[model samples]
Target: HGSNIEGMLEAVELADGNPLHLAHINAYCRGTVLPEAEETELALKALAANPNISCESYLSPLNGTSAEIIDGLPGSMVTRRCLKTGGFTEDEAGMEAALLSGWAQVNYPQGQEMTLLTGEAARDYWRGQQTLVSVSFAVNPVGPRVRLATAKKADGSFAVDAVSTDGGGIPRNVLLAAGLALVDLGGLSLQELVAKISYQPARLLGLANKGSLTAGRDADITIVDRLQHSAFATIIGGQVCYMDGKVLGRGGRIITTAAGADYVRSQGLEPLVVDLADSSLLQKAQKR
Candidate 1:
């Protein structure tokens, strides 16, 4: 969530070893203000030294976050930093002006995509729909993204951790396609790509049975055409929930840990406990 790896590491140290999932880390790995490649190398080195932390990066170049102004200030720290780094005004008035000038993009929830907003139109939109808007920053670079995607551990598992979309309804669902692209480009093997997208994330969430094709596991699967590099089918628990752009049925069920066992059972769902130590994040940290 932070751009400065040093700052993030300090925060982790201050937290006294709490498990942390650093989100969309590649967004922070490259930038204009800081030394670019050095930042990512330092971040990865720090990560290797501390296994208590894990991170995931989206494949896309644009980073998205809420555009809320907190007490006349930017809502997202990254947005603030990006604004300043890009030589734009970093204050509230500057942000408003930037939006109206079509320099910054606004993601309207109803519109479902990023678009330029400006002038009275921008102010009117913010006044009427502030709560329903997010801003996009073109801060992510491809070099760090590819390096992070392909980084591996001693056992050949991903070092940067998981493949994140940071995309659900916002529609940046390119994890599988982009990962496969990486594979095709020789940046990573197919198995490593799968681990980054599935196994590693499942391990992080402590969902031991959800990431792989092993017997007796959850049949959650995403069937993608290797040639097309796209997903045409998605199955959950042996049920074809989605295929060919059509929803078959609402087949999802709640999945939780032992700590939430009472709630899971109360909701008529089964509890699944995966040892936190089973995660490669912690496993690698222990080795350190």
Candidate 2:
């Protein structure tokens, strides 16, 4: 919700003790108020002091948003922010220029996997799709991403709650490959790495049965290639959903809070209800 470290801190103060979850904390620390790492430090400090707020960030340099243009400007606020950050106008003409110059990357369909397209091909794909595709821009820098993923508070608790892809609904999924890189670099231990990507997040969401490999816990697992640092297989609820480049699971149930169940059903999705009463936010509030 905040644009920079100063605004984010001000926003947290403005909430007046309400529970908050800051999504993609690294994306906002673009060296506006200070250097990127300095801004990140300020954010971590604020988060460490406040138990009411929880947050997550990713390692991808690319940020995802809608490619559509309505009237003259981009339709999504996030896309406009990215274009402005890249020194481009918020209008369709600027978007076209951005695509032509390879700054705006369109998610194009290849064989089985989605890949990035730039320059003329990207521009044409966007136009051909009637400007209704997802686009990405290299807006996130490196320093803040690294710091947020592994920073700890005075009590040794994680400053940020999880490592998330932001699910920009594009190809920004880099949690495993990138997080393993941190492990290899000694930024995190294998156990701590599992917690950030799994355990901590599961606790935040109140998924009591998921996250760990302990006895009586759900067997949701992601097998990874230690050398390549990519995912090899995925098991959900003790069911092997994916393995060896084949998708065995048919569809996914939507993970939603009580308030969102009606909408999930409206979208023809089966809802896997999770209670916010058990969520980390309310628990943190109780501690406070």
Task: Please give the clash total of every predicted structure, in order.
Answer: 2, 0
List candidate 1 segments past 4 Å from native: 12-20, 101-103, 111-124, 153-157, 258-288
Name the candidate that leads on TM-score. 2
- Compared with the true structure, model 2 gives a TM-score of 0.91
Cα misplacement distance, residue 210 of candidate 2 (Å): 1.0
Model 2 ranges with Cα > 4 A deviation:
109-112, 259-268
Candidates' lDDT values, in order? Answer: 0.73, 0.85
List TM-scores for all candidates, in order: 0.81, 0.91
Q: Which 10-residue window in model 2 sums to the lowest lDDT?
A: 164-173
- lDDT for 112 (candidate 1): 32
